[model samples]
Target: MSKIDIRTVNVVQYVCPLREGGSLPAIVKADDGFLYVLKFRGAGQGKKALIAEFIGGEIARAIGLKVPELVFMNLDDSFSKTEPDEEIQDLLKFSVGLNLGLHFLSSAITYDPLVSNVDAMTASKVVILDSLISNIDRTAKNTNLLNWNNELWVIDNGASFYFHHNWKTWENHLTRTFPLIKDHVLLQKATSLEKASEDIKQTLTANKITEIVSNIPEDWLISEADSMSPTDMRNAYIEFINAKLSMIDLLVKEAEDAR
Candidate 1:
């Protein structure tokens, strides 16, 4: 695996929780003097969610989409000491280690399909990306997309790559059609899918796939443990992604038919 250069920061303060979703992610200030949206490791989905967030962010960026900078957040016990809510306190306790943070896009608004207009190429890329990762969260009801600085920035990909949730069934997912693509907020707007598919496959080289999965923190890898070691887990992701990569044509066909 090639060396990946990702930022690491110590979370200095828990600003407030974003209660819009059940997972309860929080806004936080870090030692670097930047505010971030921190995704806790102890959330119901566990560290595999953070792994998905990290890898998904890179994948989106690689496909020419804007994703907020992702950083590894170090959370100690002190950050949770003053919390008033027991639920949050428990969340802090379980997340007392490396969490994931996205550089907060101040004043960003949710991407409402009713109002926002995305060009076909950009929309196509996002559709292909969500399909490739099997992201079920980008539906019209809860589009995990934001409009920041007049640009479409993808966020909250923790729900993608769900194959990791059950090791026994992971292999079965690689070639399957992403049925959820039809529900994607941008699916009907994605007119350039064939071009987008070629571009995505061009960008996702084997080395790039390895690099993305290889960057998963060992902590996240261990959280998925029933029997596989972290190294084994990493290899499994490489295999999974490669299989998906090899069958991009199938995924594009699904996306095209869904619209």
Candidate 2:
């Protein structure tokens, strides 16, 4: 696996709150002069969401999907003072450290299946990846896709890897069937799941998975009290993903049946 470098930037300005979900990610201007959609570590869902964003987005990019470049944004308390909203101010005050940032796509439009035509290959790959991660949030109501520069970009993968919330049961849940693909926005339009499965198997090698999960910061993993060390948590993620990869064929069949 090649070296995966995630750049770290300083937040220069607090633009506005996205207010899309409970996490309340915001749009901010960074020192690098690029606007980013920042996900706060202090949000209700906490660091696990950031973990999913890093791992899932990297995997999507590895498997020939276009994902927004992810970066680490350093936040300070001074930026929190500028925010007018009390709730957002509180969020910023608590998130006074490393947070996840998604490169903001200027003039990007949300993907709508009715108006946007997606090729079967891209749709199939998205469906297969979502199923493998057991993402339950990419339904038609919330596609979590953006149409930018005449291409589709997958985003907001914080909702993937649902089983991670309960570490004790994670091993038992690794091989459980992911039935959420039935509600996936691209399900009906996707074809060639077998080909997508093969491509994913080739692209996401063990080394690649290791590199992806290792990108997560140690602090985030240790934020909550747990017996596992940061390295152990990273290895656990890799193990869970490998187990999921072993069942890709079953997942593909499930998606095919749903379609």
Candidate 3:
């Protein structure tokens, strides 16, 4: 896979807050004249959520999923002063540095699985990707998918890699099966989990995994309790992914049985 170069843009204007979740991500216009769904680094989840978004979105794109372009957005303190809402102002003030931004789809519609038709191959690939990354957010209740220009786009991957939140027990769960796959929105429509796993395994090479993990900003991987350095954290992520890839067959079986 080719290297993904994430652009850095300044936030020119604060449009509005997307009050859907607790993280307080907002829709902001950037200096590039493109609107972005900006995830604040100072939000409740902190930088780890941004790390997950970067890694998960890039991995999804590598395996032929349609994901919006990601960029590093610089938030200036002055921009927060214009906000009318006190809560939003506080969020903007706290996130004064680099934040994760997803290129916004202006007219995209939220994906409704009941009304939408996703083919078997695409569904299988999505399931495989989620399982590999241990994303527990893509349930039927909240697919985290968007429909735009007749294409399905994956979004909101910050909820992935839950194990990273507790690095102390990360090793124990590294080889564990993802039981959450049973509730995956695409599971019923998915077929051929083995083929999907093979396709992802072929695309997500070790170097590509390292590159994706390395893309995360050094400050985002802040060490806690002297557990590991930022570089070690990146290596740990690569190690976990590689270990998961080695056990693709087991994950595939788990998903298949769930379906």
Candidate 4:
């Protein structure tokens, strides 16, 4: 895990529920100043939720998006707890959550789909990354994109890769035809996005993809989930990131040629 600096004091004893699922609002003190409340995954969501936030947020940040900072927490489990239904009551009944949380985003007042900003090429890249990771949570309803200080910030990555069944199944997700390969938007504006795909392809082979997966935490893949082990799930993601990196070169070339 990469080192992240965050202040964890002024822990609010309770969590104020937010409209979003698996999250709550609570006040805390950070390095910048006092924040009214930071949004955290519901206590019932458990540690995997925090891990998802950490890894997913890091990937997006590496890809050059403004992602809110996430940190491990030490909070009382009583804040904003949820009751379980009959089917999975046992599982939910005994779960405790780490105060592991992210920096409170103060200015994200609303969510707007910037379809124009997200040109067809950029859209294709986003979709390609989403599909390869088996990320089914980024629909219109679940787009975690928000406008803040005149720019966009992305959030919520816990629902990705839920459909990964095996290593081959995972590998196939990365094998898309790259139809919109010509329209990568980041090619022109951001150097990071420029030629990203080609760079990734040059550096990341199947073996490297496997190594990335091998690094995932063991608890992330539910035992009953698609019969996947943490290793399988990790490998699945390795393919996604490696493919994304490879696409960077194509993106850069497209941008340069367009200019």
Tens-digit lDDT string for candidate 2 (49-71): 99998898999998899999999
Against the true structure, what is each candidate's TM-score? 0.96, 0.97, 0.97, 0.56
Per-residue CA lDDT of model 4 for 1-259, tens digit only, reads: 2333444443443324353554443445544454433434334544455555555655555444567776544445443243333322232233333344566677675454544254433334444344334345665555665566766666666655443434445566454433332333232333334344444344445554454345444544554535666655665566566664555444345434543
How many clashing pairs per prediction, in order? 0, 0, 0, 23
lDDT of 4 at 79: 32
lDDT of each: 0.88, 0.89, 0.89, 0.48
lDDT of 4 at 214: 51
For model 2, the superposed segments whose C-alpha errors exceed 4 Å read none
Model 1 Cα RMSD, 1 decimal: 1.7
Report how far off residue 239 is in candidate 2 (Å): 0.4
Query: What shift in Å separates residue 78 of candidate 4 from its native position after superposition?
Result: 4.5
